[model samples]
Target: MTKLTLSLAIGDYDRARPLIDGRVQVDGVDLVPSVLSPEETFFRAFRHAEFDICELSFSSYTVKTSRDDCPYIAIPAYPSRAFRHTSLYVRKDRIKRPEDLKGKRIGLPEYQLTANVWGRAILADFGVMPSDVTWVRGGLEQPGRPEKIALNLPPEIKIEQAPADKSISQLLSEGDIDGILTPRMPSCNLTDPNVGWLFEDPTAAATEYYKRTGIFPIMHVVGVRKSLADAHPWLPGALFKGFQQAKALALDLLADTSATKVTLPFVEEQLVRAKELMGDDYWSYGIEPARPTLDAFLKHHHAQGLSSRLMAPEELFHPATHEAFSV
Candidate 1:
């Protein structure tokens, strides 16, 4: 009869909503949502032992390096490429080809994100080393403070802070940065005549890498306290079910324009983006952490010196609640 409080970082809520809103109810559990960005929520929860279940970015876990006594059971998210949505977008006027990026300034939200990692890998694929380009940081550019997630930066990396008054988009428009490594927002377009898709296809190298390595660097994971999981063993199952329900709801809504009309603007945008990137498989239930993808991530982490040793997939994910639910 006791309720389980789950805290998830802000952007993560879309993925966690099903468990909180739908799945827990069928198992006679209650989930409460707490709004916080992944880093703030993670540190707060870890410091105060605040929530029963939570979600945090994998970069956060690697950067904090404070897993001891942490009650959270790390769960694999639905397997997807590490840089699924992130990419290196260039301006067509400046860079006629990916090779042309060799000496350009690249803008990143932060130097520590998987987006940067993937960007580096993509550059490597194009034969452009880190020394070949200038790295610029601090690109969140909206009118508010940036989210506090760990950037997973190496000691040697220097982050250039952007001016507080200017947004990254504004800089991009003004030609301050040659290209940016970030997700494409609705207002942004790779084919906009101004901006060019640098890699042509961002996932090509990743797909090949997946075939070579069986691990995928997981970007985000759902974490729940071990004690909470022990006390409420049904929580994972319920959470999974909730996600399934949410996926269904999202899909149904996507199908019916009327339903999407009621959702948040960002959520609607995310749904559209999800469909465009992931296709029909986006709504499938359960987490499917791609091993090959994680392996590639480990290599990048080591290359960047973010981690000395690669974490095994088992070390990263909690044991499956059941075979059917395993990802």
Candidate 2:
């Protein structure tokens, strides 16, 4: 067989390091992987279609997919996932609870960011809809950042671009915005006394939310170029199997007790607690395993005016990735 050669751009995550280092290889394919930061990878991929396969923001992916002009088709291999409770930063004196956000100004890097969508969904659960808050969109640390993809938001949803000279984090620090939905913690929260998390204990709040909702929000998915997938129908499944094997190896390394594979202490304890809370395959990657999270995100994406319509969870993934042969 003539192995297909392709370029892949994804975050330098432990779960994907095996593929990057060639410990795991996609069957019938030769990968030239670039381990880039998620922000750059998403921007280049969505804007220019620079790579044969890449990591994509789920929100932006859905927006393009719903428009029926997306350049790539995703597999169920989620490269990034997190609970979004920790993604929200607020003024301690102003936004004490989720409801406090109603009618307030909120700053975010982009209206179509996956983390912000999940963060807004958290507010919606508290009876605050997207329309209830005014959103200021801009870069988080630097000025002039734009949405990776265009969004056709509903008229009722309000989003304004921040001043060309300032970033969203600057707006939060200056008290121009009541709160912020961010993929990363803002430097203002570290230096400013008034900036804090709405959830006093984000970990506890996220755990409680998970217990109630069974959702581990997915941030990024792996996408193969549509032209490539169409030319080689087997590509999606090959990449899927490669990622699963890589993840299993990463988990095994984490479970090893002799020396912690990660820099964090109490790796074993955290691993044990995670399995207790979410089961053995907590960070599972597949349509069936991730349906609840996917469904919730799709609903929120549409409600927040990112998706053209409410998309089925399965629609985001390639058909070859929907199921695998069991022997």
Candidate 3:
């Protein structure tokens, strides 16, 4: 009956809840779940080690800021029924093709974000060089904040301060920005009546690239401090079971219209988005990063110079747990 603290990002809780809700059992251990957003939860976890487990992005995992001793647990990849592809949105009347983006100013919420990273990679695939366009960095608070710059951006790219009063969407609507790189969600509709989608499937090219190069980018992952894992060896197993249970519950709910209707609005929206981006076959099972997937991610991480050395997927994750839950 050992109590294990499990932290999940707020944005991802809907999918993770069932695992820690006590329905899933692992070696007779029970998992207790707590949820928070990535920044708030991880920042606190790093300071106090308050939670035994947490969910984090692959980029965040590679960052120098993260604790070195944390061990990642691979979660099953559930086809994001609500997943949407990121798109390069431009003022419809202004730019009609990908080539038209040359010399155009593009607005980004932050450079360090996965959307930006993948967006840049996608642009490269389309024959756009880093120097061919102007990049604008947004969401700054004071005169200088190092977090303001996304990361590892080349010198040719210029960083402009976004307005303090308006949201990026608002700015795009005002025609202050020629284009933006964002997910294909309704909320990111560029606010401009003139704004239209330039690239329909930004990740498609990347996905193909990954399949070809065996270098897929990792988005989000569940992490546990190595100290906590050592203190409680059974904890990792318990968590894996909990996640399996959650995935089962999610699948069951998705199959039931009555249950789906009662779920959170965001969950419903995600389902729609996933279908649009990944198509109908996406929801057959959860999406878990397997060995090949992790290997692909590691290769890309190294190529991007995001990590100093390539950390083997086995080193970053719990070996036994991953094998037991191989998806």
Candidate 4:
């Protein structure tokens, strides 16, 4: 039988490294993997449908899915998951809490980014509606970055692009913006005295958030081009099984502390703490396991005027990945 040759673009994560390096392979498929940054991968994928399979921004995926125009169909293999408390940076003297963000100018790379959506959702929990703040959109490292997908936001939400010559990080450091909500830490935060975190203790805040919400937010999902999935109905299940095998291998390596797989100190202790807080399969993938987090994100995605309507967790993935067959 001839194998299907497909291009796969995803981040260079340890969990995905096995798939990238050929230790884990999708059944009857020849995967040509590209290890790219999320920004570049998402940009090329959304704008041009450049890859056969790729990691998609959860928020943008939902936006397109709700419109019924997405070119790719996703499986429930989440490649990126994060807590958003650490994603917000604010002016130390001007803003002290989430409530201080009201009526302020907050900078972001894009309004539809999954991280920013979660960041805004965190603020909403403090009674800060999307309409209460002016969002300044610009690139994080360079100027004039635009949203990968066109958004038709509601009139109540306000967003303006930063000057063509300035990045959001530059705007934040100069006090032109009161805060920045981004997936990446702005470089100026290390050098600028004015920049600091809104959550003084992000670890504690994130822990408390997990304890309260039971949500370890998902950022990215694995997508297969719709045309390809339709042609090869078995492909989505093969991809899901491949990703699960890769993730299990990575976790096994992480738990083996004989030489410390990661360079960080106290890796064992950190792993212990994570398991204690989030259970053994903390970074679980699949629709039902991640329903609450997905539902919460979909609610915020609609409420913040990104998605045209609210979507269910199952709607984000292909039907083949909804469940697995058992012996």
Ranking by lDDT: 4, 2, 1, 3
Q: Rank the candidates by TM-score, best first.
A: 4, 2, 3, 1
lDDT of 1 at 179: 77
Kindly report which residue stretches of model 2 are placed more than 4 angstroms away from their true locations once superposed.
Answer: none
Error of 4 at 36 (Å): 0.6
Q: Which ten residues in a row have the lowest lDDT in candidate 1?
A: 77-86
For lDDT, the strongest prediction is: 4
Residue lDDT tens for model 2, 59-147: 88889999999999999998899998888999997888889889999999888889999999999999999999999988889987777
lDDT of 4 by residue, 133-176 (tens): 99999999799888899999999999999999999999989889
If both were scored by lDDT, which would come out higher, candidate 2 or candidate 3?
A: 2
Count of backbone clashes, every candidate in sequence? 22, 0, 16, 0
| Candidate lDDT (C-alpha), each | 0.57, 0.91, 0.55, 0.94
For each candidate in turn, the TM-score is: 0.67, 0.98, 0.69, 0.98
Look at candidate 1 and tell me the lDDT of residue 112.
Answer: 55
lDDT of 2 at 99: 91
lDDT of 1 by residue, 1-327 (tens): 756545543344444555545443535555666666655665665567576666655655544433343456665554123554236677768886667887777766655565566667667666876666776655444633343443344545544655677655556666887877764441345325687566566566454654464334455566667776677777766665555566565556556665454445666666676566556664343334354555666666666655545665566555553335336
Candidate 3: tens digits of C-alpha lDDT, residues 1-327: 644434443234545655545454545444455656655554555445565566655555554332353344433342122111345777777887767778888876655554455556656666775567776655422222234213554456666767666555655667777777754332436244686667556456445554564434445566666666677776666665666566667656775655554546666676676566545544332334355555655555555445557777666656546556435
Off by over 4 Å in 4: none
Deviation in angstroms for 90 in model 2?
0.8
Off by over 4 Å in 3: 1-14, 25-32, 42-50, 65-84, 129-132, 140-160, 163-166, 183-190, 200-218, 257-296, 303-305, 310-312, 325-327
